[model samples]
Target: MSAKPFSQGVKSPIVHTPSSSSTTGPEQDERSTPTADLKSAHRKVDRRLVLWYSFVYLIMRIHVSNISNTAIINLEEGDGIKAQLGGLTSQQWAWVLSIFYYPYMLLEPFATLALKRFTPRLWMARIMVTWGIVSMCQGATVNYAGIMACRFFLGAAEAGFYPGVLYHFSFWFPTQRLSFRIVDPETAAFLSGPEREAIIADLPSRAPSMDSKTFDLDQIKAMFRNPTFVPFLVIWITHGIGGFGITFVLPTVIYELGISDTAISQLMTMPAYAAVFLILLTLGYFTHTKRLSPWVAGIGLEVAQIIFYILLITVDNATAKYIFVVIATAATQSFFPIIWPERIRATSGTTSAGLAIGITNGVTQLMGIVGPQVYQPKFGPSYRVSYSTSVGLLTATVATIGLTWLLVRRQDKRTEAAAIVESEGVGLPGEKDRTKQQGC
Candidate 1:
């Protein structure tokens, strides 16, 4: 019985299994992410980010687009009345629109730098509050100069909002998640609708009173530090130019196509309204289902806008021109939301994302100020100038998107390479032995 019991003693291995709680031994490296785990995380985050972004987009669209419409219409109305008072021309009207860019453009880089320090939420709230006040004030102007003053401040207030939002979207969606493209079209659509509404609201008989209010810069400064804004800058700038070209002249073009001012005003709003509805629907389904590439959707819409402008301008027939204007209006309005917030998301965290988005939006808006001038024509048909300018802008947007795609691809490769190098233990010169000694 004693001999039988002696045979069962177990032999121990040379290396002891390190206790889970022990920190003294080599730190265990976490294994690479499992494919299923990575995919699951991507899918889960994609749905949530898209859903949240879409909701925020809807709110913004209602406010910003309406402001854009009101600003231009008020400028036109003020100029019309001022022309009777001081005998000003359309060129001065163009200047009123163009001058809004000077301060707006100058502030963006500084704003961009500032985003490195703030949170997006605070920054956006500040921007919205200021612009909302300025937007309202455009209605109160009794003269062209007064309108001009309001427009200038309006530019200054809204400057950083779009870019900042773009920065916000970049955080939760990586390139593979396909959310970056989601920002622009949605934004365009939202802005377009309200713009149309403002146009309608300002009808010869029924315009709403506008107000000019002040906001706290301190709150804006606070949003500069929040980090989540990597994607916002590029996408915002890309689509910003396109938006300017469209918003600046789409109404005028519609008028040229034999549409009545009343009909044009009401019809123009439809494109933006439709776009908003579609964006909300698309974002809810696409972002949640992980079924759409924001880049593809955004670029495709931009291309459609360009084509619409080309068709509208080149066709000799009035009926065809009218048809194209409607089509272009509808299509162009869809890009804003998809592209805007996505830029902010790329920026990283919500705060920096906000700043980045604000900067991009602010800077790009300078294009809006400059746009009326560029398309206003020195001597002749401004319609031709406006439509052709839009073509150039849309082309640039496509190029910018191509560059962004490349950047995203390179980033993916670098991520993969770093992961591989980390796994291979190709430690730096003196670090290998140190790591071994530390049992890492």
Candidate 2:
């Protein structure tokens, strides 16, 4: 074998074995195997964690929302959950329903902070256990005040769980993967690693670095000032108001549509919820596979809801109305999953992201207060006013989303232009500028 020479200005000569194409060096083989194994292990663990948290979230939602069913049962004359306790008036019941949200809204921001101080596992467990206890206490309430107290405490206990899970997922996944909707390859190509890192680094932290500043008045102001943040607030609030308005009174609405039997009406709700779940799964899979824009999908669903609300208000056929109700439920419920990830992705850092998530959760839960008030007893049976109000809010949501899409497009253009300029500038030897090359 001849010795290969290395020139001062040139690289060393390359040597290739006859089997080089079929085999790797010992170091290369060793390095690749563990990395591949580690990735596979991580994926398995991620799937299990996602499934576990999803189940937890489902139970929490069911516990919080069962109050709506309880209220309707109490309204009925016969023996029911509400009748056995203390019977509450329409106005009084509204108060009971809305009170839970008061503490819920107030405590959410603080909960985000607590999640930062304590580990998510511990904090989330504490939230679930306490809320579960509060939920059980509701069964023992004797009067409006007792029920109200239980609801209030329940709200306080459950306040942070949803947002906490969101924050927890943000830690495990990149923003794109965290998003329920799919990202198109073109957009994916433009997303640079540093940009993603910057997004992650910006999340609000409990402990600020010696060189880094803490989340303060200025950062708060900056967050609100961010073009994307304000629109998210609007979208979340309107979505909450519209979504809860229908959901809280859904059982009653079904009963009013000539389903005289209470059990039948409750059972009827099951099919609608099941249909919505299937729609959500289908939409999630389709959007992910097709690389569809969540904004576009969300807007389309909101428009469908608007049409459904119109049909509910104007149509006379009971069967037809029932079908529309099911469609509307599925559409409205599916919209949140599409939009929420966008909100999380728009903000940077843990503190700002937490604040964004917290504020959005806290403010939107105010719908609990507004929702019951909208579907008052005065508008009973038909509840024309309630449907009309939902239509208006849904319309507003569409407009807000449109504005957000425009803003995002403008931002993308600016980013691309800036990257091009940076790449055009000269750089050090052997180092090609990747600003434009990365397409971000």
Candidate 3:
């Protein structure tokens, strides 16, 4: 073709195929692939969140499971109040044994609120050290009443740890990555990357980073607005009743295993450390991998407890019963760290993280109060009532899991549908665009 000449003398040459870098028509179509890549990048998990979550779960694993270990230790040593104090009966022993769950449950919800008010590291460390001291005190008690008082204080001091850790989990992980982030180390870290990014991205918006003495009030306010809060209150209530019920029977259960009281106490200690290690491993892996739901893992273990209880009751063979007991102990203990944090995050970012956890602790603590009373030897030595009560309470926990699952699933569907609509540049056909007019 002839080239176009100077001063519009000849017809202009026709443009052919556009270059790859063309800036003309259909530029929008060329941008679509890069847009998708950006979206995927936005969804990637952060690393720091995973590390933090694993650390918190580790602390909780030690805090919660150690109670059983210590009780077992005391039983093995024949260090129970009845052994130390004169004129004490099985019923009184049971009462003292069951007292710890009371304050622990009662304090959980409120403790969650406290998590919001203070720095998690400091507050959580304080609770842990206090409980550790209380546990040490239990070792020193001279009589039944003294042991009883120690158990009560132990409950009060330890009440906030699990829920506080959970509230911390929520602040970092989004729904897509929660269970995996908590249980699996690698995946959890992946999920936390975005969280760190958001904070770092906002550094310009915030005043220059300050010393530990200064706090971030804005982040604290974000917790209350978290939607997962209300449903978890009900979940924590069930956990309280179950934890106390089972704890009250542990010593007696050991007695039934055909072991001497001293040996039983020592054997129970094995599971406490076992729980800490197992939880750290499983949660660290599963959360990082994003393979399973923490709720599923926790509820599954509680349901498994029914089988163990049945084995303990039906198996006259001492060796078999002891084996089942060990298995049950490990499984049941693993759930606490996983469940509490998952629950708190559902309604997180409130100034009330500490208070919410504290309340949960208080309510669950009542299980301690009633559990020993119901299983007293005045009813019988075998204490079938205690085992049956545990079975029933665990069943209730399974039901709670199912209900909570359905509720969370519904919320997830809504969230997903909203996300899809936003990506597609469309509005909900019939429903009002509330997110458009009002901020989420």
Candidate 4:
């Protein structure tokens, strides 16, 4: 019992203990590592790419939004380009504006399919350059038909770009990280070999097969059955109609608000546009952090818009009317980002997601056709008809959102119930012999 202790040259069978640095094996190390570390490793490359894309996006926004500004300047200044096209009636101008949507809506789905078959970098470059040329041609057009033709071609060129980018994001990000709104090249790169195989192994059996290259018609049809899809479609359409109507008539409205100077009228509209930009960014952040339903946001914003539109139509005070106009414009523009990610998140497979986005965006853009018609010059100054129409549309949007939220909640409960039954090794209510039902 009083024998030599273990450390006293007893040479106890050498027990090996792992050092702190070498404790984790490769797989464990990968699993335990922080996602932020991986993102930071690729931050340099991501930053450069983001900067480039941001510049491109900025240019695209300018090209699209400048049409409203250009139309107003031409109508009011009656000089140079204005004199050439100013004689055109408001109805004719509406036609010009509406024509842009025809090709855009019809071809967007096809464009998204093409993106799947090609590299996004190449496809996006082609789209941007072609649209740029077409935008310049629009400025040079001398008459109604000329501008209309340019707009049509421009729409054709830019048809799927926004939705295509969204689809591209789906390929590069996981569901949980999608709300981060930043590019994650690490995910893209890791999803290539063994890591990808490991991930795909865990996905549901219904997940898209990796070998399938072509789009599936059945999958596209199934998207229509998804509860999230129709609501998003309706919300976007109503929002687009109301938003575009406000945008096109904003300058005229400002002028009629007793701002006599043409430059002053144009300048006054800037604050509203600026407010829209800020509101979108702020709402995006808020919704992401709170895990808020897009429908809730949509309903809230649409209600606000309805209020603003009513005031715009009923209020007589110039300043009060202008305030309402700005608030309405901002509310209208803020709903898209909230709803877009929600709709796309509900879609599963890559091809299905692309088609869903393309179809949703293409159809919703039909608002372009209706938007100009709503803001006719005959209703100008007061534009009572226009504001009334907007209120109606916003009300419809709120109803659609309410329905969507209900469906989503119901779906969540179903999912949770299914998971509970599975975990408990229980058969469905009618089924007996849970052990026998295991395979099924």
Best by TM-score: 4
Off by over 4 Å in 1: 1-88, 109-125, 166-239, 283-290, 339-356, 377-382, 423-440
Q: Output the better candidate (2/3) by lDDT.
A: 2
TM-score of candidate 2 relative to the true fold: 0.78
Encode model 3's per-residue lDDT on 1-440: one tens digit a residue: 00100000000000111111111123223332333323343344223334544565566555555544443345445664455665468677666657776677666666655544555546666787898798788777777778779978987887766555544443333322333343111123333555434522321111112121123354334433334444455565565555445554565566655556655455554664476466646764564344556667767777777788777667777667667667666666566556653443332223333344445445655656776676565554455666677677777778877776665454434544554575678888643342221110
Better of 1 and 4 by lDDT: 4
Give the clash count for each candidate. 80, 9, 84, 0
Instruction: Compute the lDDT of residue 293 as modeled in candidate 2.
Output: 67
**Could you tell me the lDDT of residue 387 within candidate 3?**
64
Give me the runs in candidate 3 sitting further than 4 Å from their true place. 1-80, 128-150, 175-234, 248-252, 268-288, 295-299, 340-342, 351-362, 374-381, 419-440
lDDT of model 4, residue 237: 86
Better of 1 and 3 by lDDT: 3
Worst-scoring 10-residue span by lDDT in model 2? 4-13
Candidate 2's displacement at residue 173, Å, is 1.3
lDDT of 2 by residue, 167-231 (tens): 55554343333333111111222335443333223322221121223245544655666676778
